[model samples]
Target: MMSSSPESRIASLGLTLPSGATPLANYVPYRKSGHLVFVSGQLPKEVKEDGSAFFHQGKLGESCTVEEGQAAAKACGLNMIAQVDKLKRPAEVISRR
Candidate 1:
């Protein structure tokens, strides 16, 4: 699957990489303090609540289809970008650890 740069690849796919991933938990996606932005862990999930997730706690080759895995992966990536976008600039994020 050779193609242009990542940025262009997404563009060809008719998608734009958001600043970063979106937070799955109650925490905000990103933070802003100075001219920088901080993002959090992002995961892939069906955009609509009505969507279905047939694969969970299973390996891709065994239970999940290549296409299904692809969709989930894309969702995860999108969440990351969404996180970065929410921030006006980078902010320090606190970790539970």
Candidate 2:
């Protein structure tokens, strides 16, 4: 069978890509040089269904459990993906799970 596309997989997992985050400082979200696209570091920020922003806070080892930290990392990754989507390049950007 043919594998599903990334967007299909993400939707099947009930994951909605949040809007691209605004830079807190003087920096762009990503930069593309030739075939290589360099994405900046993303925070664990997300937009809730009610259009409110959410992010994980506190020190990981001191105030949060390992599992919580992992969740936060996943949020960060999602934010990064959202930024990449903003590039508007109609190509396969995600290569792995």
Candidate 3:
């Protein structure tokens, strides 16, 4: 049996993983203990070619529409995935809080 690599799986989905982000505070982005890994919260952000961040900024119920909020949520998930993928291990996400 042939196993698919994580990167190859991502590419097969027609999605490119975004670059990993630096922690905004004085804490580490993730902590790995034993076989469990805890990742910090990530926003819907993208680093541009010029190194500027592009993200949606607004309250979900106030300024953003439902569709926009959904998009932002998807972006946030992608960002979190990117962070986990940086660990260079196969990640099976169990749940999202």
Candidate 4:
């Protein structure tokens, strides 16, 4: 049996992985040491087909509701996965810390 690739899985879900965001500062997004990779915190930003971005940009418990915060977290997860998919061995990812 042939398992679907990560990009295929994402496409099957009717989703597209947006381009990774540029670093806000001088730090790189991820660092790999041996088999372990540490991905930095990512924000909730989705790029549209026209290249505009849709993002939740407010502090939780302040201007954002619980549901909105949850959505933001999900977006962050997607972004992290997108970053991980670029790895040399994406299928080898064991667990996300």
Root-mean-square deviation (CA) per prediction:
6.9, 3.5, 2.7, 2.8
User: All candidates' lDDT scores?
Assistant: 0.58, 0.80, 0.78, 0.81
What's model 1's lDDT at 33?
54
TM, every model: 0.47, 0.78, 0.74, 0.74
Across 13-43, the per-residue lDDT of candidate 2 in tens digits comes to 9988877888888898988877767777588
Q: On residues 1-97, what C-alpha lDDT tens digit does candidate 1 reach at each position?
A: 7656545767788986544533447897655656655555555543454644332234689987898788777776666655654544434444343
User: Could you tell me how far off, in angstroms, the CA of residue 59 lies in candidate 2 after the best superposition?
Assistant: 3.2
Write out the backbone clash pairs for model 4.
none
Estimate candidate 4's alpha-carbon lDDT, on a 0 to 1 scale: 0.81
The candidate maximizing TM-score is: 2
Candidate 1's error at 54, in angstroms? Answer: 9.4
lDDT of 2 at 51: 82
Q: Model 3, stretches more than 4 Å misplaced?
A: 1-3, 48-51
Please report, as a residue range, the 10-residue window in candidate 3 with the lowest summed lDDT.
88-97
lDDT of 3 by residue, 1-97 (tens): 7899877988898877887777778987777877777888678876678978789879888998888888787778788888888775745666654
